[model samples]
Target: MQKKGHRDSYTTNNQKGTVAITDDTVKLPKIGHIKAKFPAKINGLIKSATVSKDPTGKYFVSLLVETIVEPLPKTHSNIGIDLGLTDFIVLSDGSKVANPKFLSKLQHKLAREQKILAKRRAVAKADQRKLSDSRNYQKQKVKVAKVYEKITNIRKDFLHKLSFNLIKNHDVIAIEDLNVKGMVKNKKLAKAISDSSWSTFTTMLNYKAEWYGKKLIKVDRWYPSSKTCSGCGHLLTKAELPLQVRSWDCPSCQQKHDRDINASINILNEGLKLATIKTVGTTGLA
Candidate 1:
């Protein structure tokens, strides 16, 4: 059960039997022949349909369809990705994708809108009127919701494109299994970490890799990818590689390392080892 005044969406299962779709309309069980815009041609068996109303008062229907996905042509390329707040991702091949920080970019605008919302709410309260009945308050509420919706859509778009390109280009992709939940416990970094949306990116990578017949190897969270020397297999002490240290020299090999790049390389090597083990175990090979 959802909390009162909080439920904004519901789903209908077995939509194949109850729902019908035409080029320009959708027929739900109760709602008959609602005109809808088709973003693309729907060419699959409909399993379920979700109807949702956003805080901004926009209604959307999402159809879950079962369809065969054709895998992309093989690139035979592999890459390791190190996710970070500074750069969204650092590739083992020395490439970096900048963190877009969608929330931070629009934070000031959101705050301005939210300030109006708060004032409107106060006005309603001062007038001894219920918030639900206040027109101005509702309007400002929608404005705040629109800002949040914009941020979410932008972030999802970036993640989808990045994940799709990585899946399309790499035969095997390796990424660290970060302890995001634990990492966010740090109050100072929580907001930035949430804005980074690492979990969403990794989730995208996981599903897309499977859909495209590719491999996604997750290096264990415990692995000290950042502290290990990618070139010489030497591990640095925790004191030697503090959180603020961005670059370092390997003591044993005297090799220089850009922290994120070295971590990505190490993650790739470890992922390859894990893949080899899995392959050997599956094939019963020496």
Candidate 2:
């Protein structure tokens, strides 16, 4: 089967003449040495390699290497992060990370590219041209694809940096178990939720936490982190806490709280509780 404008990829085993990696280039099974960029030194035995061409006409090689997972030095710091659309992440330590909003920033450019692509497709259709034979349409399609690819790369870079920072500095990283799929069903916040890419960020945190021997704790989604007071442990009713209220004062303790930061603190406390229990018995969210 073939797609009109889709990526093509293939994987090769590490058998003889299958795959070989050098300082700057990689030798594929039959495709001799190709110029490549290796961002980091490959530190392990190469197991396999997969090569693929993206819709934007860029090629990439992903090497599967087997290496010893070395843990990072302990920093003895624990942090809780609250992910949100307003700000990307709010830490329990009262630090806020602004959302990059990469897709939103490039929306106008993407719209222009999409319009051009649509016009080219229309012209090709009017001429009854096959998509594969329509040079203009294909070219415009690649332009549109490149715009999307750029946004994806920017988002991924941001996530990697943020995850690395947290994993490297913190011994325990606590975050809420977000119901991203359900959150996106809200039409008003759907775009923002999708743009934040909370799931991808959490996945990065998970794997990196493991690699660095850090604890990644996911508190239960149903926990009343936002409604509970971090200082007084007072639980506010759902009716009392609304989305519009970004800051609130605890009735019991009279302590003012930034909504996200308070929730992050609560998450951190709960995660620590879980961690304490895990040391003695089975590990669980509760």
Candidate 3:
């Protein structure tokens, strides 16, 4: 049987002696009160708290905060986003946000650290030293962990900022529902696809849209956004609009289209249609 990595965590409920919270500190059973920074104010009655440690050896406490948030004022502007490997996101407005491949950029550094860690592990193994008892091995392991942690933090920060901006400014946002798992099956594109982090971005858009009272529409993945001509609505066969052809003139309308931008426009239109249909159905019910 394969061994599973253990998860480090403990939970405490809101009792007089168990867990307590103040403006800038958290109190645990035997640890007493520890000073902590609050990114946002915690509202509502004291709830249960779960303290967990991540692979990076950093500790985090998750508080179940029951709070109400007022929705921001509605914005009339809407947008469509096309996720691609070349650009992180191409918006319907013709803006291309370059992909900051954090992991790719730091691959060399990570490889160097892993090399050192491997040497340490090998020495420990050759000497018949237990890995748990090898101080050097453990130290090198943490070094490797820190690199991974940095990459995760950078990607998360970028995604959160981008998602927040979209939700704050747009009334409705449209994106293709990507089959990320299936797409990653291609050996050539798997690394690029994973680095793109499309799934995480869309997930953030989904929840943030709900929290901010904005609309997030997911067009079908199989919808031929790329092959359809935005000008004349003429659909091109897969052969005519192959992946290699990045730009082309529409035969039906004779208008030139930048492949990704044109696809974003199509996505925007489809999203608007879906939003309209939903609104009509809701009004009819009311």
Candidate 4:
């Protein structure tokens, strides 16, 4: 059971043999063939479908299918990723991906629409009318929802493409086991951190690596990847490596380091050690 005015969608389980999908339409139980546009061809056997409606008044159907996925060709390459706010990701190979900041790009427009919706809600309450019965409020609500949906779709698209590229080109990928939940507790950084969507990006990397038969490793959170110098393995004190310092010189080796790239390299080294241990344990070989 769903709470009143809470759920906007429902799911149908064990829909195998009860549902049929074509290139452009889906046949569901109780509902006949409905015209739908799919992003790509559905190739596998459909097991279940969850039909959902967005606040924008658009209906969507998600099909769970069983299919065989072939692994990508081996590249014999490995890399580490450092996730950040200014840059989306910095790789151990010295390449960096810029943060798209999808939410920030549309913040003003979204704010304007949301303000209008709030005013409409106030008007509806003043008239002693249910929100569902208020046409203006409903319309404005859809507008606000559309803005949010746009941001989500754009962000997901970017993450998927990036994750796919990394999986396809590399045999092993290492990333930090970030405590995003704890990090977001900082009031000043909460909005920026949420907008960065670090968790979503990592989740994409995890599943994509599995699908491509690639290895994804998470370095321990307490490892202090950032405070260590990649070149000479020199560790920095907390006072020496402040948050504002993006680059620094190692005292032990006098090696110049870009903070994110140095951290990524450390993650790569640590991940390789972990991977070797895992392999030896599984194979029972020294």
Clash count, one per candidate: 0, 0, 0, 0
lDDT of every predicted structure (CA atoms):
0.92, 0.91, 0.90, 0.91
Best by lDDT: 1
- Backbone clash pairs in model 1 (N, Cα, C under 3 Å; residues 3+ apart or in different chains), count: 0
Indicate the residue-level lDDT of 161 in model 3: 97
Which regions of candidate 4 fall more than 4 Å away from where they truly are?
13-16
TM-score of each: 0.94, 0.96, 0.94, 0.96
List model 4 lDDT by residue over 77-114, tens digit each.
99999999999899999999998989999999999998
Q: What tens digits encode model 2's per-residue C-alpha lDDT throughout 178-275?
A: 99999999999999999999999999999999998999999999999999999989999989998999999999999999999999999999999988
Say which prediction, candidate 3 or candidate 4, comes out ahead on lDDT.
4
Worst 10 residues of 1 by lDDT: 1-10
TM-score pick, better of 3 and 4: 4
Single out the weakest 10-residue window by summed lDDT for candidate 2.
277-286
Full-model lDDT, candidate 3? 0.90
Q: Between candidates 1 and 2, which one is better according to TM-score?
A: 2
Report the lDDT tens digits of candidate 1 across residue range 67-161: 99988889989999999999999999999999999999999999999999999999999999999999999889889989999999999999999
